[model samples]
Target: MRILLTGSAGFVGSHLVERFLGEGHEVVGVDNYLSGQRRNTELFLRHPRFRFVEADVSAGLPVEGTFDAVLHFASPASPPHYQQHPVETLLVGAQGTQHALELARRDGATFMLASTSEVYGDPLVHPQPEDYWGHVNPAGLRSCYDEAKRYAEALTMAYHRHHGVDTRIIRIFNTYGPRMRADDGRVVTNFVNQALRGEPLTVYGEGLQTRSFQYVDDLVEGIIRLLGVSYHGPVNLGNPDEYTILDFAEIIRDLIDPRLGIVYEPMPADDPRQRRPDITLARELLGWEPRVPLREGLERTVASFREVGEGRPERVGVDA
Candidate 1:
């Protein structure tokens, strides 16, 4: 299949490109590099079945071709990137999504959206389910990302229902692995980088805030399965294993350097107090569940970070 994938230079998007190319699919990747790295696209520049286009999907997709699948993964995902480019975040979720959907409609192709767990926004529900209406703040510090994904999901459904476009929406949980930007301000990269440098790991607030981390490979697998399945509604794709910020910090410290200390700092506003995806829907529908353990995934991630020597102590965003 020939696939049109936006945000192909992103951490997760790059992984998807590898998988898709390996499976003998022709992929046309698009990215604006707002948060994605150009190095990622370089990994596939020589691939026979891959092509990369440098353009922002928010304005338009410049590629001209009828694709079998259109996966919309563009947008600044991390707090720093989205907060820094708040308007771009909103535009991508609004205009970028519309552009992708329109292209998919034009080609009569399958459409898949990469939505985030931020939509839950300090979820009141203990373990969030697909049926739960999220507790998101429409106007808040994190609203740029949270509301954008929420609106994107709504738009995806609207396109699916009204236009009969084949659509899939996967609510991605806290995914981390190699290719993650060290300066992205996410907790995983921050802790890993700081630990590698033998610096005190920064833990926001009491470090009681919980999050479910999903390895990128596992997430890519779930995405592949969802694409093959017939489900049209949103499905949670993440690991069920939960960990507090403090405990996660300890794990990273142990992996990198056991002597690294943990330091508490002020929590960011609208940070989710808890997040654990109820993947029961994913399990029953797609027969998918995260396979990589946290420690193992962290080991691989640390190896990648160490190889590149990427580390810096900065304000960490706990929202995954």
Candidate 2:
């Protein structure tokens, strides 16, 4: 299969790109750098099955041919990056989706948008289902990524409904793994990086907010499965093992470096109090569920970071 993957240099995308290449698929990677790191995709540069393009996804993307799959994973998904460049973030969410949808329409290929669980902004629901119409605050600090993804889903469905383009959306939950930007400021990376550096882990809002951290490998598998499945619209792809911010911090401290301690700080405005995906739909439709446990995943992530190390924190839009 010839797969066109945006955000290929990102933490998750690079892992996905590797998986696709390993499966013997022809892969074309596109990244604008933004929050994505070149080192993440560095290993794929020489692979005969892989090709790369350094272009902003929102800038009227160019394409060569029909692809078997179109995985739209571009856009600054974390807080720092999206907030730093809000307009560019929104444009990628809008234009990137349009460009991918258009390409899918023209090529008759399957289109899948890597939507975020952040769509369920500070969700009121316990275990958010696909049918839930999220409680996002359009004017909040988190709005850039949340609303952007919300609208991206809208555009994707619009293309599917009106233009007959094959489309699918996966609401990815908090995922973390190797090659994650140490300074990305996500809870996982922030905690891990701080631990690796033997510093206090920053705990926002009394460290009470919760999230189900899925490993990147599980997420990549779910993405591949969702792409091949016949589902339309969105599906929740994340681990259901919710953990409190403090508990997560403790785990990382214990695993990576015991010297790391926690420090309380104000939770950012509009931060979700809790997030746990109801993967029932994913199981039924894609026959998939996360296999890696949080402990194991964290171990793998810590080991990876130890080897490569986070040089300095690069501000990235915090993601789900």
Candidate 3:
């Protein structure tokens, strides 16, 4: 299948491009390099089955082709990146999603919107399921990303309902692996980098905030399976394992150096106290569940960061 994937140069997008290409699919990737690093796509530039286009999907998609699938993975995903460019994040989720949906509609292709666990902002419900409506602040520091994704999900459903376009919505949780930006401002990367650099690992609040981390490969697998299925769903694609921020920090600290210490800081406003996806629908429908263990995943990620010498302290300040 010929697939048009936006945000193809991002950490997850780059990995997804490789997966599709490896499966003998023709993939045309679009990215503006806003938060996505060009280095991530360096290896794929020579692949015959992969074509890269440097353009922002929010303004418009410049590529002209009939694709079998239009995967909308654009937008700044991390809190620091999205908060730094709030308007761009909103525009990409709203306008960029519309453009991708239009392309899929035109070509009769499967449409996939990469939504987020942030849509379940500070979730009151434990182990968020597909049915959870979420507890998001419409006007808050994180609202740009949270509400943008909420609106995008609504738009995707509208298209599916009105235009009869085939649509899939996957609410991605905390994902980490190689290719993640060293300064992406996510918990995994931040702790890994800090530990590697022998700096104090930063923990926000009392460090009781919880999150579920999924490997990128598992997420990509779930995505591929959902695309082939007939169900137009908002499935939760993430590992069920849960960990507190402090526990997670200790794990990373032990992995790198047990001597590394943690420093507490004020938690960011509207930060989710807990986040764990109830992937019952994914397991029942797609027969998908995460395979990588946290220890193994973290070891692999640390090796990748080491290869690129990415453990240095970030030059820019970011909220925790």
Candidate 4:
């Protein structure tokens, strides 16, 4: 099948392109490289089954021809990227998503939205399930990303219900792995880079806040599986294994250098105190659950960072 995938140069998007191509599908990739890396697309530039276009999906998708599937993965996913380009982030989630859905509607294609766990802002629920209404601050600093995704999910459902479009929404949790930008300001990258540089790993507000980390491979697999199923509601795709910020920092320190120091700072406003996905729905519907352990995933991530010498940085910041 031929597929049209936006954000093809992004960390997760690039991985999806590789997976789709490996499964013998033709993919037309699109990205404006806002937060995505050109090196990622370069990996598949020469592939016979892959084609790329440089365009921002928020404005419009400058592409022709029909596709079997339309994967709308475009957006500034990281905190720094979204915070830096707030308007663009919001536009991508609103206008960009509509454009992708329109294309899917036009060609009678299966549409899949790449939503995030941020929609469950500072969630009151311990383990976020598909039914939770979420506890988000609509006017907060992080609202740009959180609300954007919430709006995207709503639009996805509208397209599905009103137009009879086949749609899938995957609420991606904190994912980390190869191709993650070193300066993206995510916890895993921040800690990994800090440890590699022999610098003090920065932990915010006593480092008691917790987050569930999911490996990219596990996420990509769940995404592919979702496409094959008929479930159109939002599905949680993440690791249920939880860890506090301090404990996670120690794991990174142990992996890179046991002697690395850990420093505490004020936590960001509106940051979620806890994040753990209840994947019972995912298990029952898609027969999917994360398989990679945090340590092993971090080990592989560290190896990837080392290969590219990507640990040197001024200071560490996290999306959470």
Per-candidate TM equals 0.93, 0.92, 0.93, 0.93
**Candidates sorted by lDDT, best first:** 4, 1, 3, 2
Give the alpha carbon lDDT tens digit for every residue of 241-301 in model 3.
Answer: 9888898899899988998889999988756446889999999999999999988899889
Best by lDDT: 4
lDDT for each of the candidates?
0.89, 0.84, 0.89, 0.90
- Better structure of 1 and 2 per lDDT: 1
In candidate 1, how many Å is residue 284 off?
0.2
192: Cα error in model 3, Å: 1.0
Q: Per-residue alpha-carbon lDDT of model 2 for 1-320, expressed as tens digits? A: 99999999888899999899888999999988887887766778889999898888798667687798899998777777788889888888998889888888888999999999989987788899999999988998778889999999999999989999889998998888888877666788878878877788888887766777899999988888877768896999999987888988999999866776688888777564477899999999889999998888988988888777453443333232
| lDDT score at residue 49, model 4, on the 0-100 scale | 91
Candidate 4 Cα errors over 4 Å, as ranges:
265-273, 310-320
- Give the count of colliding residue pairs in each prediction: 0, 11, 0, 0
What C-alpha lDDT, on a 0 to 100 scale, does residue 130 get in candidate 4?
A: 92
The all-Cα superposition gives candidate 2 an RMSD in Å to the true structure of 3.0
Indicate whether candidate 2 or candidate 3 has the larger lDDT: 3
Error of 3 at 142 (Å): 1.8
Per-residue lDDT over 1-320 for candidate 1, one digit per residue giving the tens place of the 0 to 100 score: 99999999888999999999999999999998888887789889999999999998999999977999999999899877898899999999999999999999999999999998878887889689988899877988889999999999999999999999999999998899988988867788888878887789999899987778999999999999999988998999988898888888988999888987898889877564468899999999988899998889999998888876657422222232
Candidate with better lDDT, 3 vs 4: 4
Q: Residue 265 lDDT in model 1? A: 84
- Considering only N, C-alpha and C atoms within 3 Å, which residue pairs clash in candidate 3? none
In model 3, the Cα lDDT at residue 206 comes to 94
